[model samples]
Target: MTRMSSFRMSAWGWLAFALVPLIPLPSVAEGAAAAPVLQGETCSVPGLMDQIRRGLASKSPAYQRYLRALLREAAVTLPGAELQAAFERETDPVMAEHLAAALVARSEREADREAMQVVAKRALEDRDPAVRSATVRAMRRTGALEKTGDLYERLMRDASPEVRMEAATNLVEDNKFVYAGQHGPATDTAVAAAAASSDPKATAKILGTLNTEKLGAEAAGTLQGLLRSDSAEVRRSAALALGGVPAEQMGTAREALVSLYRGERDTGVRKALVQGIAQLGFASAVPELQRLKGIDPGMAPEIDAWIRALETGLQEWELILREKQRLQQAP
Candidate 1:
């Protein structure tokens, strides 16, 4: 027998998976022959909803969870319009939250305009943080690409750290998905739109991907603005991202990176700034890298590696002389 070792859920199925270990599922009558498992059957949405309603009315957490598990299973097979309607009419905010996620995850209508519109409304208007959190997933799953970018930029400043982090992560991850498709322009557009909001995650994603020099006079000006952003994460991300831009694309980025190193307040961000400057592989950065090594002996190894790498890139003749000397000495 093949054993189940792990599972992945793209949507809301985990709700059931979490509870199934604790509660015993309903058993078939012992005297009656067990009904044959049908291969092509789907759960009846209305019938299951009746049971779910009853379970909720029962006011037992266990029973509600049992019903929730059942709903999660049925959500896979439920009609999209019907699921949307169920969500619209659901009275309990928690169940409504789950239903919205399921609606976006299942059926062909996940991308329906009306579906995304309602989910966006709930994400904005709902006072419950949990409901708002779930709606972010629903919004990402159901909303159009441009709209999703816009929503994510707004949510990046959300009061709830969890929601803010989720928005930030999704902004980059969703951009990455466009990259996976090899839709290069789409990725650039998505990141550029959100990056303009000055959110750290989106800014990093955009900076790593765009030829910022092509943004007319914004050129290195955009990067300079980013380094001065109020958010340390944004500044840190900008420093790291600037390292990724090919030097030919913006030679000035190396200067920007090195300039930030001395004044950067956060030790971790300073290290990232050093890493960015190191990645640029400019020999001029060696002096500062050396200064950092002297200031913090703990940074010796990384600093030394950067120094060696920069020396090799900038002074290949030095390596050739050392090699030639070594060969003569070998005799």
Candidate 2:
């Protein structure tokens, strides 16, 4: 499927790492009302909270959700004193500000980290394939590469091509070494060829030097076609590649993707449908995706999730419909 460029640095290798933990954990006053929670020991809730708070302060949406989940956990296990200690000891000034703001908004930090972990783990191990696919996506985004590589490799060899397809797609995107021809030789093919090549590095170097612009339009159209391909691998790659299209030409591929979502029977293709729709911000497809639930109710929760993301996902659709009406009424 589509290739993506991944960050060269580790997730923890951020500016916050330099600033936040560098500050010493604050000591309690001689007559403090209560002692700290797990003083001198590794407390998971605080560590998790710090990670999430730093993420939220950086305005990282991915981390914001992660932090929200962690805050939920803190509300459950940590007393206000413990939270205050962790918050007071935060080294990063910017993060400290955000932590203060969030404290004002929330009444109780109510999250069940243990329960969430169990759900995430079970999803990874679920017999229901769709649940597993969703879990894998969530894990990858949240930087939970703990055992993801091994799990992905195993899934690649699974009897169900669907599972293998989703895992491969996620891995390919996460690795950032895969590229579609739009940017030159597709990374998927290059990775495959390199694995079989005598000199994978040289092949990769050659791939790096290719003229990506040469294949631009062809790559866009190819991505559109691949989204509808019966082969799961092709669909996954296409979905990933679709993300790489130049913004100017994104509109060019809209009609083709809309048609695929309406007619394609493959679940992998439909999954790609959600991605492409989000990327292009094709609000017109909202009604179509909404109707698709009649064809398949299982997509309801996901549709609701996507819709709830930005002011209930309604403003965008309403704006699009209003623009259409304006165009229709114009001369």
Candidate 3:
């Protein structure tokens, strides 16, 4: 017989294998097998409250786990009272984190200012970084961060990078509150710290905010320096921000973008620099773009297109300016 045939099970062994399925297995808990299906029903307030209560009251670890899963599934429909009650009753750090996450999800779907405030307070006081991060995320979703500039500024300095990043991003999103009267000093301080942060993501986010808020000229020098950052993302963000610099500052911005482009080796960063240069629409950049075109065979096509676009844009701008001047000089 072949080696494989010799190793195969005999008829009696095969018969035993076939009969194994007929043997009775141990019974599972009464509702354990159906827990997942039952959990889906918890989307109603009463159903969710029942799950929360059972999750809190259960002594069996498996039952508690199933109930918690149910609460998580029904979190979006959970009312403020149940979420608050769950938050108060949960003592396990892990379970507390889950409850906090659930609160965030619920707050996101419904504009529950009071519930969001309660969670925000908890997040501020929580000893756990994960919980704090989750709360910040919740606050972000509810637009609560718009008026909590100071809290976000404090969180920006948190030891947890995740929390700090969350705070940084929220601050940028709600920058109007940060720059508003009386809060301007604190907001500027936070922004300055973010600009100088070692965290590239934080720096990139701030740069993007500056661009979006049309404050690029206000931070022109900082943006220019960030183009040399080790993080390609930050450099790209800086390049895009430079493109938004005010017309009066276009001279310095154009020069900086071209210089960075000439020395940049990263294709992505180079493309961003070209876009910035093209956006600035400086007639002087045409020669620089032509010069850089020969350095990279792959980039030549893109660079040529930018040059053509820039030339067209500059001509249109000149025509508009001349028309304005002629109209001003006319009777």
**Candidate No. with top TM-score:** 1
Question: lDDT (CA) for every model shown?
Answer: 0.57, 0.45, 0.62
TM-score of each: 0.57, 0.32, 0.51
Higher-ranked by TM-score: 1 or 2: 1
lDDT tens digits by residue: candidate 2, 138-187: 43322222322344434444454454555545444444432323324343
Give the root-mean-square deviation of each candidate in angstroms.
9.8, 18.2, 17.0
149, model 3: CA deviation in Å? 3.6
Candidate 3 on 210-319: residue-level lDDT in tens?
Answer: 43324434556766778778999889878876775667778888899888877888998888888787667656678878887877778886776666555554455445
Error of 2 at 148 (Å): 32
Candidate 1, run of 10 with poorest lDDT: 1-10
Residues 303-328, candidate 1, lDDT per residue (tens digit)? Answer: 67667656665455345335434543
Q: Compute the lDDT for candidate 2.
A: 0.45
What is the lDDT for 203 in model 2? 28
Ranking by lDDT: 3, 1, 2
lDDT of 1 at 116: 59
Winning candidate number (lDDT):
3
